[model samples]
Target: DRCRVTILHFNDVYNIEERPNTEPVGGAARFATAMGKYRDQNPLVFFSGDCLNPSMMSSITKGKQMVPILNSLKVKAAVYGNHDFDFGVDELEDVTMETKFPWLMSNVIDTLTDKPLADGLEKTVITWGTKKIGLIGLVEEEWLVTLATVDKDDLKYLDYVEEGRRLAKELKEEGVDLVIALTHMRWPNDVRLAEQVEEIDLILGGHDHDYDVKKVNGKYIVKSGTEFRNFTKVEVDFIGPKYEISTMKIEVTSAYREDVEMKKIVEEFTSLMSDKTATTLGRIESELDGRFATVRTQESALGNFLTDVMVAATQADLAILNSGTLRSDSVHSAGDFTIKDLLTILPLIDPLVVLEATGTQIIQALENGVSQYPKTEGRFPQVSGIMFGFDPEGPPGSRVDPNSVKVDGEYLVPEKVYRVCTKAYIARGKDGYDVFKDCKPLTDPDEGPILSTVIQNHFTAVDIVKGLKPCRSGHHQSLIHVASVAK
Candidate 1:
């Protein structure tokens, strides 16, 4: 008798509903169609995780929209990603209970009970004909501190390597023929795990949207990037006492047709959401157009306007924000700025925070912000008050000229204290603002709501374009010049 199993996998499908109107890409509908065709030959379908949360479409529906589609397509199992906890454990439980398939999370522990998630844990052993396949799931514990909002006072994160080794030992003792670790973690961490864990035969990974397959210490590690753009299909042929991987194929689902039923469900959900989000707020006198790189590199009319709003909202002496927070770069046409536009541009729930810091600390914070301009960092500050120039070619710490720094039309005074306004993310040292760690908050930390929502409410009827201007000069001039001239 010949035994075979096929594993169909996808990752980071953040509920993109329709086939992209502009670009050729896979949406949930197209993915369902592709999965249907694949299931005809083989039955197993798995997602590495990050299936829900994020995006206006999923948030509005409270993750109800994707449940019907996943059930129709028959996803066997999925590892839970950090984003799944965005709405907290209760909401996650609600979504899982509604899901037709089982949700897996081997690593995520409930702080209250001091145990792993109740829904799925350790491994799920499925006997396919004569072959017994073991599936284990792991979620990155860093999310407990980085992304999750639930009071983590009760939750404690465990060591992945130790837990993984223990779990593999247990599964091996259970007479499992093969082990598959469905890991929702960074690529580097997955690589490390594969090398360290000897019992693990294969790993289906997510997070850090990169697609590639590499073998570490005889273990196969595969990641199928982000946003449902690509999926991996692994065909396994099991011969008694031995196993062979016949084919590991990565397919682009955008080439296929949209799943009709899934598409219909998505359309209905999107329509209902549109009825609520499509209301016209106010007309823009002209287009508020800019890109993250374009606006941050120099001065952006939109950036300036947004920074001004933050300063006004907090009554801070200065304001700073990251251009990366602005997600979309599309040119807005002269028309009403709907809730859709606002949501697209600023999606994260980062609240505004006002802090009082000595002039020396503010300068230190500015230096730290500029230090992040390198390729890997995302928190480089875009300012509204002070100005300075940086030499990208210069080494770190030496990039910005201290002599050139200025605030409020004068050289930065180390002795003076300035009321600074920035997103709560930075105040908490999220995007690399260690200087803010010791700073005192001028206003209560909980006073303001998410800064993105505040901007939307404040500018409900205003033309943001009218207030657009470059916040910083592109020239390598002194901060004194930037403070005096840009203002």
Candidate 2:
């Protein structure tokens, strides 16, 4: 008996629609159109997770905005992701109830009750067909330590390889002909899982934010790039004991038409954001570049502006933030800046947090921040009210020059305390800035203003070169651009 099954997958989706004003490469509406074409096959639409929060709209709707769009797509099941907990367990539970599909998570458990936290989550499943396929969902266990919103006592995540292998073997024992793992984990982790658990026939993964595919032990592993830029389709043809599988990458392009039904749902959410996004937040005197190629590897004017806003808003001695937070991916030419533009640039909804750190701790953070200078790493520090030079060609942790650190025309005193403003992401020690996490908390999360609002206020309040002293110019004299040195 020959039968065909099409497996469609995407992950790390945040924006419910397309890039603010870019191509049709993203958006739930576009994805709906892409999926509609294969609806005849009754394809299994699998999501690897991370969609519950992080986009500008999620801040407003608390992840409710994604439900209708996802419901329209008819997703079969999705795994858990770190970002899914951004809104805390209760809010995530609300979304779980609203979803039309199964939210799978086999490793996440409520320690006190000794069961899954939400009734909405699926433990394991055998999808019925000519060939039965067992499905299991897994998330990286590290979120147990770093996830911010969840109470430490509420939940626990079991090790991925240990739990996943145990579950996959059971599915095999249950007489399922094939087993698949939908995982929200880095590709390397998935590769390791494939090696350790050979029974799992395929792995659909997320979290690296890039388009990737690999074959290990004659099994297909795939991850569609983040934000729905592409979706991977796996066609499996089975005839009795024989089976053939093939994969293709499908781009959601401007050329693709939106499904009318899903388009309405997308547009409804878009309309809610249109006014906020379109309104002019402030003006810029010169072009600010927030391009990833620029900010992640160099001291960017956009980074300077953002850190300057943090300093001004928090009234801290200085502010430091990672360049990776900027997501605009394009230069903002000098002119009016809209709320939408800022949202696209600083996509995360974290609040501005102020912390107290001594000069020694700060220097350690500066060294750690620039450890990945030549390569593009997100921890590249953008600063306000200070200056420093680094030897990028030097070893990773020793790159920053101690003699180079200065504030207000004086060298930083090791014992002196200073107030520093930073994003909650970094303040919580993400991206190699652990010294920041050890610092004394100054601004409480609830009291701190939302970062974008602070930047908007800074622009509205100052509005002139004289008031914007150190931040007036974007160029940093301390360290030369790595690209320039490379040339």
Candidate 3:
């Protein structure tokens, strides 16, 4: 018998509507209509996750606004992305509970219950005609240490490879005709899974935000782009277990026909953000590069400017920031920087904190920050008051040379304590940076101004409203990847 089932997949979506309003793309209401037309293939609308937090709307409602939008699209199930944990466990659990679709997580487990984080997150099976297809979800194990807002004590992340094999074996034993591993990890990790697990037939992935379609080691792999701007339409020919895959991109030049049922819902949510988005702050002449690849992989001008703001806000001797804190990838042209821009980029609601630390602790922290360097992990450090050289070829924990560290134009005193400012997330020792956990607080996080307000205040007061280049000299300098040391 020949059966055809189309799988429609998207990942890392947050905005319900497209930006700029001129040639817009990415409205859930529009996406619903775009997806609704495929009635013949019994399309399974799937997402690879990361929609819930760091979004402008997530700030106001802790990701509650996403419920109606996702429900409108009739999403079958989603694998969790790292940003799914940005709002903390209770809020993530709340959003998980609110959605009509099931959220699947095969590797993420709740410690207290020794099970998947929420009821919606259990593994699922889909009946396609006469065949039963099993779906398994997995997140990168380092999420708990990297970007997750949950307490490390309350969660467990089993390695994805082992968990994937176990889950696939069980599903095959259950007589499912095919197995699809849905995941939100690096593309390389996805390839590793395909290499190890022969029972798995396909992997629809997210997290890198690029459009990729490949046949690796005879297993099919696909990743549609981010912002719901593109998706994969996969047709499975059941007679021979063969497949045809292609990517469909929704351009910004137009909008798809509105899904009338979800029109009012999107409008209402847009109304809630009207006042906030309309409020303008300062202006910039040049584009601020907040792209993940730019900030996470190298010294970005915006990253430097931001860490400088943090140092000023706290009056600390130095400051440290993680690249994941800034989310926007588009360069802001010469125009007003609105409250919306600030909130959109730094949407985690993470508070600033100042702590006292010795030079030895600082060196260890820097080593931890760059351990994932050249790989574009979230732990990459953006700094305000330090300059140092590092050897990327060095092993983990030995990359940063302690003697090369200097603070405020002076060499760091190993015995002397330096006042360092950073986010509450770091102070709590999140992201595998446990050194800050023991540092005594010089300024409480609650007493400090939020990230958005600090930047706004700085721009209005000190920044000249002219075409400007990124301020990466003092804050974001490390001599690696350069042809030679400049100094």
The TM-score leader among the candidates is: 1
Candidate 1 — what's its lDDT? 0.67
Query: What digit string (tens of lDDT, one per residue) describes model 1 on residues 1-487?
Result: 5577888777777756544554437677777776677766766777787665655665455466768877776788888876665444545677878887777777766655555664556578877767777888976654544332343455556677777888888888999988888888877789888989888888888876767888788777888766666777888777777777744555545578887788888788888897767755555556665565665465566666667666654556788786777777766667787767777777776667778888878767776766756552456677877777777777655677767767766887788888888877788877668889899985534333345544543442132223432211111101111132123
Superposed on all Cα atoms, the candidates' RMSDs to the truth, in angstroms, are 12.2, 12.8, 14.4
Which has the better lDDT: candidate 2, or candidate 3?
2
Estimate candidate 3's alpha-carbon lDDT, on a 0 to 1 scale.
Answer: 0.72
Candidate 3: pairs in clash: none
- Against the unseen true structure, what C-alpha lDDT does each candidate score? 0.67, 0.74, 0.72
Clashes of each: 6, 0, 0
| Candidate achieving the largest lDDT | 2
In terms of TM-score, which candidate is stronger, 1 or 3?
1
TM-score, prediction 1: 0.63
- Candidate 3 on 1-487: residue-level lDDT in tens? 6777778888878677765465447566667776776756688888887887555565555467788888877788898876675544445666778778778888877776777864335568888677787899987764444432344566777888898888889998998888888898878889899898888888989877778887887887888777756777777767755544444554423557777877788788777776667566665655678888888877767777787766655567888898888888666655787767877687666767788999988888889889987998888888878887788999989998888899988998988999998898888998878999989986545334456545644553333223232331111111111111111
The regions of model 3 sitting more than 4 angstroms off are 21-24, 119-122, 240-255, 274-318, 321-487
Q: What is the lDDT of residue 359 in candidate 3?
A: 92
Q: List the residue pairs that clash in candidate 2.
A: none
Candidate 2 local lDDT, 410-483, one digit each (tens): 99998899998888888889998999878998755533455664554444344333344232112111222222
